[model samples]
Target: MVNKNAGDIQSLTRMNQLYEKLLNEVDVGIHVINEKGKTIIYNKKMMEIEAMASEDVLDKNLLDVFMFRESQNSTLVKALKTGKTTKNIKQTYFNNKGKEITTINHSFPIKEEGRITGAIEIAKDVTQLERVMKENMLNKQNGKITFDTIIGRSQLMETVVDEAKRATRTSSSVLVVGETGTGKELFAQSIHNGSNRSRAPFISQNCAAIPDGLMESLLFGTKKGAFTGAVDRPGLFEQADGGTLLLDEINSLEPSLQAKLLRVIQDKSIRRVGDTKDKEVDVRIIATINEDPLDAVANNRLRKDLYYRLSVVTLFIPPLRERKEDILLLTQAFIDKYSTLFNMDVKGISEGVKTLLQQHNWPGNVRELEHTIEGTMNLIMGEDVITIQNLPGRFRSRYQAEEEPLVQGDEGDLSESNQTLHEKMTKVEKMYIQRVLKNNGHNITRAAKILGISRQSLQYRLKKFGL
Candidate 1:
């Protein structure tokens, strides 16, 4: 109905092109969510930070793409709800691909003539940087976690730790394979600290959190005039030349770029995005994968040749469920940490809470346990010990589901043969004691230490069990 001319359309298209260039050129991530929590605009840098395609994110509810624990857990969602600015906040969440992503974000509401319209968030991916930078002061204010900080008493963990310590002795490329929250970056930082390059820089980047279109330039740097507005810049490799460069989620990188990365690793040199010549670099490469490297290789997510090269020194961190013995120990450590920080008198957890914690599968691994304790700490109301009531509702429900039979008449599964509660508990205790004993090579003191019981009590149990 309105008069629309070709020149007006051309001008509008040019303005859109300019805006698009701005979104792509900026280093920081930009995400704009509508009032309804749907993504209206997600820029290239945001794509890099989230490692999501525009088609995957745009026009979809932000909550659908991310597995944030709560609806308010999303800064953009929170901004929309509160209509307030949130700055310098650290957010940890799981993406659709199941990779854990951590970011430092600044979020604020966007308004049109004093009326709330949508929310915008500027983010910097700190998925691995949070380990070294220790920037997440929002919740527990945790700092760098070194080898000494790693809590591993189980044989599986001890073996992995010993192998990681050995990798520090050499600068050979190391591949740390583990699930999310298993502390792959923590091990990487410890390796760097123990290595000869401790004094130099330690840089970390999550390949899954970066877009492949910008991956090459970010990793290999760019020269002036490489494109319009391109400036001569040093890539992560050069910045970490004298130190360690940790590439988290390495398999997320495109195959073409992976091949280039392989070339750089092989040659110890890198060619900038537009530079004609290659510059030699001395960097210790450490790469991590959330899933099994073999699975990644088979799925073609990771190149087989690159895997072989980078895995010259490989370390696998077992998930939390595999080593339940560490759960209580880690819980206490977290309690001590948070209590010291909050100055709360939370000395210990109740027996019921302990049973529940140990019963939990901890799909998020150690990180989940840490946060569970942290969240519980915030709920403490002059309680000396944490109880089942203090746990989050979801935790309580899950624990209940595990303890009770889903069907009312499934008694055979739990109370088979009309066994008494004490007898069943004692059976579980004896089984655990035997497993710990075998794991510790039948060492009494060592097993007792792991079990958090006195050596005398352990001896008494052994005598009673006739083992």
Candidate 2:
């Protein structure tokens, strides 16, 4: 008595749902377009990569959303037209909102019975990674970074910096722990620059950047016959001999590699892949993790013994939200840095923009703040002030529209915000000193030592700021 096609329809619906799940669940962005250049399938990651919604992309023309009518930059279009596959191609494009996004894509043409039907492209978002690489390159080019290169003045930051400065005097393996974008590498570089190995080669690698198979040789060099196309080369450990080797995101390393790393730290030597003999190398290892080292060990992401070996000198960089005093300071600093770089007459941000920046929890920390300013300046046009209108959608979406921009005279929001930053710093200092005093039970010398200041200076500040 059932409909004849009921079973087929049910099967089809379930298949579509499974297909949808496959597209969305993958880590990489996926996009599929028909022969006519119309976007037929766009997955969740693609939406994140392009910063567009399903309504804006689904069933829309590719050229209309991403490029000019005849632009050749779209990989989706290229595969469709050529009926060929393009692998590991880096493409740079602006989204519908005009924000620059860079992705590494592998595009394949969908063919049915030897006829090209459509094309699918898988993409990995490399926009932030590219930006970070550029910044690291700049730091290396500019005589490397020191503690002086860091840009935080909050009490927590000051404490961390003081500890890091002390750590620079040691030859022990250091673990720099922090959330993503909190500048752990910066601290590593600073420690190296401040140490006696300042002139020696300082090499760094993000453990999460490469595949597990390649990571072993990357750290401990490979012999000529190590594997296919392997050459006799010095790895990061050998390259960083008598200097520093910074392993960023060390928790991402495989368990076997972690054991190897621990052995290397203990033995002060490394054995190249496919080589039986080990040679001594004097390399100061500085490892970074984007979480609490204890949590990393507890979660089995990091080995406990390896954690102890690396944590001989642990430096924890506070996230941006914990040190809110640095927000406006960083905002104005980035505004100035980018203004010069972009050759724009941009001066400052508006009060409403400041409210949004302070209100929003900066999950990505300082790097996110810098990129926010950079992205804002990219589209600021000829405007001197960065009003709320200049912010990206993620920030703007939560901002109230009715709020008016408040600028004091011709001074841009940034220059005016300097005073605001100073005021906020003073408030934070007052609050911190009070808490320290309370915690130390109002012992002036103990609180002063804890604050990294003289008791006299603490008394002067306490009275001067009426704390």
Candidate 3:
């Protein structure tokens, strides 16, 4: 029995030696502190990360060795005090030599027989990662808008925004389908900004803007001497590694390029236009199509396989004509915007101008409306309110052309309209409300805004009308 006990002790000593050797050889920094806050074990990687020698850190109090602000909030100290564990905490601190170090730390308490004896921390340095992200070209684009900047109160717009916010929580490929000028890129930017990869690059490429001959090299990179004047250059896929790539108007790509894109997405690697080797990339793809994606697929403009791969998450933005409830809200926002830009004191739109705006169809969507307001604001000399007379000539002509025929028909139909004034007005109101609701895809919140009524009031009317 004594000989068996002696053999167990020998085995324990050998196990401890192996554990110590394994800890020292790991790439991540490892640190251990006793319950008394004394450094018990500090691996070689930890020494290199802190730029300190073994003698300086060994057997020293953790607070005394670091002597920095982050020491007070150290995960190791916190774990020791609370007998709890903390994982994946990003920390930054200045070491003893006053050099800044940033790391992601995972710390846990060391328990012995239902009591906390010490704590161990494993840290991964991320300073170099930050440096590499900042060097990417996509990070250089200025005035990038986040989800916060997107403004819309209409129910249709709210639904789109909600779906977009949900998409940000994943690494799945996103496909945004909308008409031209429906703010597809804006939605793409919002998703990118809200994602975990926000700190990395957000490179955008309009597939239609680049010709087919050069598109391959521009997207997948090229080797030196691949073609005349072609030097070795990383493409958008390589540049956007660890980030997001916005492929605008993806349907414009030829079917062959679409096949290549699918392979890259499936294989997680790409071969340069003329290179024999394949390069791996970690990039999230956010594709935008200016038309209906299903229609594009049916028409063979987009590859079916590629469409399915990119459409793992899809967001559809309704056009301005379809969501007319947002027109006044957007108009007010634009007025504020151009007011600041053109240095105007315009505060509101006249009732007549508002009626005219509601009657006209905004075929070009939000982008067109913004430009219209900007142009009008530039022409306003000192008006505080924009009246119908102040509107552009083209807009006034279009409004007159549509209104004249409507007025003429109404005059001719008065003999047939024998109902009381109150009855006729109520009938017109109900008809208009129904039309607005249909236009907004039966979204009550949006229809309410178009009808200038509260949601509760709209609901009451909807019930009263049996709609």
Candidate 3 lDDT, 350-441, residue by residue in tens: 99888877766566778988888887886676677998888888877776644433233532333222235643554566667888999999
What is the C-alpha lDDT profile of model 2 across 1-467, one tens digit per residue?
A: 37758988999999999999999999999999997888999999999888899999889888898842233478878899998899998888877765667889999999999999889999999988877776666556556788888888998888889999998888899988778999998899999999999999999999999999989998999999878898998889999999999999999999999999999999999999989999999999999998756658779999999998998887778778778888998999899878655545577888988887887667778999999999998878667899988998776875554544556543223322224454456456777898899999999999999998878668755643445
Stretches of model 1 off by over 4 angstroms after superposition: 1-144, 401-467
Query: Model 3, poorest ten-residue lDDT window?
Result: 410-419
Q: Score candidate 1 by TM-score against the native.
A: 0.57
C-alpha lDDT values of all predictions: 0.84, 0.84, 0.82
List clashing residue pairs in candidate 1. 48-209
What is the lDDT, from 0 to 100, of the residue 296 in candidate 3? 86
Please report, as a residue range, the 10-residue window in candidate 1 with the lowest summed lDDT.
410-419
* lDDT tens readout by residue for model 1, 1-467: 23467778888999999999998899999999998999998999888777789999999999999887553399888898889999999888876765557889999998889888899999998866754343245233335446887887987788888889999889999999878999899899999988889989999999988888899999999999999889999999999989999999998999999999999999999999888999999999999998757668879999989998998887878778678899988999989877655645578999999888887768788999999999998887767789999997877776564344333242223343334564456567877899999999999999999999879668756744546
What value does the lDDT take at residue 329 in candidate 1? 86
Which residue pairs does candidate 2 place in steric collision?
348-414
